[model samples]
Target: MRENSCSEPRLRKSRLGSFSKVATTKPNSNATSENRVICIYTYDWTDVADVMRIRDELRKLGITSRIPYKSDEDTMIGKYRVRGDTRISKYYE
Candidate 1:
């Protein structure tokens, strides 16, 4: 049998602020090789503004982002998830 061509993405976490944890990974698709996946965690609505600010900043820098969604993980601070990708930022592969 041929070896599996798809590989699982590796995640690296870094603290963004007092209450934010940023997890990043190299995208699996060849079309997105220049971009890295970024997941930001927020505690609640109070923290959404911060996430929005970050998202806007990334957009200004030509990075792409997506709408926030509820996370299935119960252990997450507020169960809210904000995802984005940056072209210039460095993340572990």
Candidate 2:
């Protein structure tokens, strides 16, 4: 008799689906104002990197920007946490 070895465990697939559908609210409209603030939602570290890249690009364009610290109450969306908030001049598109 030969002994068999398994390197990885098998994962069972769900009949319904791998993930449940999560209801998401539509994003708020971008309103123009003197000191406009845009909320950037980051699901993971990748999003944070994206925000940093955008910031660099904006800096090259000589655009003023800032990322303010957000409290738990202010940044919570359902179960996801908002990575950062981008504040910019009203003239920024």
Whole-model Cα lDDT per candidate?
Answer: 0.35, 0.33
Superposed on all Cα atoms, model 2 deviates from the true structure by an RMSD in Å of 17.0
Name the top lDDT candidate.
Answer: 1
**Steric clash pairs (candidate 2):** none
Model 1: which residue pairs collide?
A: none
Which 10 residues in a row give candidate 1 its minimum summed lDDT? 2-11
List, residue by residue over 1-93, the lDDT tens digit for candidate 2: 111111011102221112222223434343233443433222332344544554454354455655442333443442222323453222233
In model 2, which runs have C-alpha deviations exceeding 4 angstroms? 1-34, 41-48, 69-74, 77-93
Model 1 vs truth, CA RMSD: 12.9
